[model samples]
Target: MNKHIVIVGGGYVGMYTALRLQRKLGKELRNRSVRITVIDPNSYMTYQPFLPEAAAGNLSPRHVVAPLRRVLPKATILNGMVTKVDHANKKVTFVPGEGEPREIPYDLIVMAAGSISRTLPIPGLTDIGIGFKTVGEAIALRNRVLHQLDVAESTDDVEVRRRALTFVVVGAGFAGVEALAELEDMAKDSTRYYRNIKPSDVRWVLVEATNRVLPEVGPEMGKWTLEQLRERGIEVKLDTRLESATGGHVVLSDGTEFDAETLVWTAGVKPSPVVTEGDLPLDERGRIKTTTQLTVAGTKDAFAAGDLAGVPDVTNPGQYCAPNAQHAVRQAKVLGDNIVRTLHGQQLVEYRHKYVGSVAGLGLHQGVANVYGVKLRGLAAWFMHRTYHLSRVPTLNRKVRVVADWTLALFFKRETVSLGEMEHPRDEFRAAVASNRR
Candidate 1:
């Protein structure tokens, strides 16, 4: 019997796991012994860590994502969402981009659906706030910041100018910090082209409910990061929460209120809500429960990893592995091999590895890193940050393209052009039709 495997989600875990299986089960896959399928809403696997650089125009957004068809030619790529997963029936209801939903049967299932931006019920947040998790959001933010500068420069209204120049980012985690730092730096540099704006006029505020930034990098580095941002004139408001952002009126829990044209929400992420339909055992956090071996606990022919999987940490008892790209990429290797081993009746190997620490870019020519018990800061950390992520960008094609982008940066200025119309390509056509009628 041919063993068919369906992998859901085409992000880090899904792409890498299928790549491993493509390499390990090449013979089985070719001879009809095994089949692989990957399903995702987007056709590409985004390297999320570089999103800040992409947004800052330091790296092209295209280089940070690997197209699913180009990366995994051997596997069946489904460009759509998985609407339902009935493990008992060995089928999942797949919905394509422009078609009705249909069921797909498989001998085994791998849930790598990943996560979504965790949001709050804060007033007007949904209307004004944007999350920084996708390539689209990153580029949109770049354009949005630059457009705000344009608005501020061309306006005479004090309130309009103030709101346009003020940018607020909530959350001080790696995502929020890097985003704030990179965008702030980019916007400051962008002031050279504007006649009325100075770098000082642009107010960048970072609000975090926690007391420090980059908690993953340790308290000392976090403290240092705070000092550095303050030195750059970035308002790092710790122990403060965003109470409301109605109509771009940002109201902080500390009894402060301000109007800002841009609000980026990067507080945290929760598992993709699609997992709720899978009928699998989920932890309190709504992640699929999995063993260290990467198999869904107490279930056969089922597996999970990445942000959506609750895999227990062997090194730290009573704790689950952190849902970061570090663990997701590593766990993918074990998952692919274990699936192959199960088919061959071999003993499954455990997925165990101590975390290697973290590195974060604080914008151009600046960064902080904690790796293997060693701390690095400033330009050295920045270089390490680029080198580390450059190595992990996936595929030689993408790596070379990313390196080329960095190399080009050394000789040329960063592109600050804003193409906001990309979001609404039909707006001009609608206006043309209205003019024709007039």
Candidate 2:
């Protein structure tokens, strides 16, 4: 009988784990006979850090994601969502697109399905709030922002113009801050082409519920970031919450009411809900409870990592590993090695990594960084942000393309064209049919 390994999700953890396992167990396990399979809805892994830049036209969106099939040629990549995990039966059930649910048995399982955006039941949010997690969402937002400008320029109605020119972003973490900065930068640059619109005509607001923004870099740096964003004409409303956003009308808890056609939701993320279907022990936050070795607690032959796993941070006793790319990448390596070690009857290694600080891009030629106890701001921090993420982006092919995009940007202007029609391709046809009937 051959041993089979099934890895779920093709994000950082899943992709890296499969890659490491293939390399480690290749020649050594030829006679032993082992097979590896990876399951994910999409066959590509998105480099999330560059998503904001992609949305802002700083980097090509295509370059921010790597095809999983190309990266894991040795592993069987299946396009599907694992719906259920039957730990007792040693089989997992998955439902691929438009197909009946299927089941497969495996000797070892690695649960790496990452997280989904945490959402609240806010009015109109479900209909209007745009997510900033995946490549598709980022590109959609870019098109939307550009389209809004077009609407603002062409409209004669003041109300329509005001709504179109107003942009609201929630949250102030890396995702929110980078997205706010990049889009604001793009919108400001794009205003040059809109005869009726200027940078001042656009209302850019960043609402953070916390007392400060960019808290990942610490308090002092966060305060500095607040000043930088405010100086750029973005209204920073801290200690505020969005009460409602209905029909383009925004009602903030801080007694602010406005209308904006663009509403971005980058608040935070919760672990993937798939883990709850299984009988595995989970933390209070719905993440898989894992030992420091990255193995599922009280379960043999089961492992978990990435945003979905609550692996204790051995370096920071009471805290679990933060759900960030840095921790996920490093944890994936340890998780893969431990899996191989477990199979070979070797000692399992515990995951322990120190905090390396944080870096964020405020816009082109602007950023903030706190690495190794040293804080950098302005152009230097911005440069550090690009340099760090560029090196971290997986695959040589993607790295080259991203670099080329930046190099080209130095000599050329950012692309300002918006393809809003992409969102509703059938609108014109529907209108044409209705007119003929009339």
- What lDDT tens digits, residue by residue, belong to model 2 across residues 254-310? 999988888899999998988998877898988999999999999989999999999
Best of the candidates, TM-score:
1
| Worst ten in a row by lDDT for model 1 | 273-282
Q: Name the runs in model 1 displaced over 4 angstroms.
A: none
Candidate 2 lDDT score relative to the true structure: 0.92
Q: What does candidate 1's lDDT look like per residue over 1-438, in tens digits?
A: 589999999999999999999999999989988999999999999999999999999999899999999999999999999988899889999999998999999999999999999998899997678999999999999999999999999999999999999999999999999999999999999999999999999999999998999999988888999999999999999999999999999999899899998999999999998789877888888899899899998888999999999999999999999989999999999999999898898999988979999999999999999999889899999999999998898999999999999999999999988889999999999999999999
Query: Which regions of candidate 2 fall more than 4 Å away from where they truly are?
Result: 28-32, 426-438
lDDT of 1: 0.94
Q: Return the clash pairs for model 2, or none.
A: none
Candidate 1 local lDDT, residue 428: 100
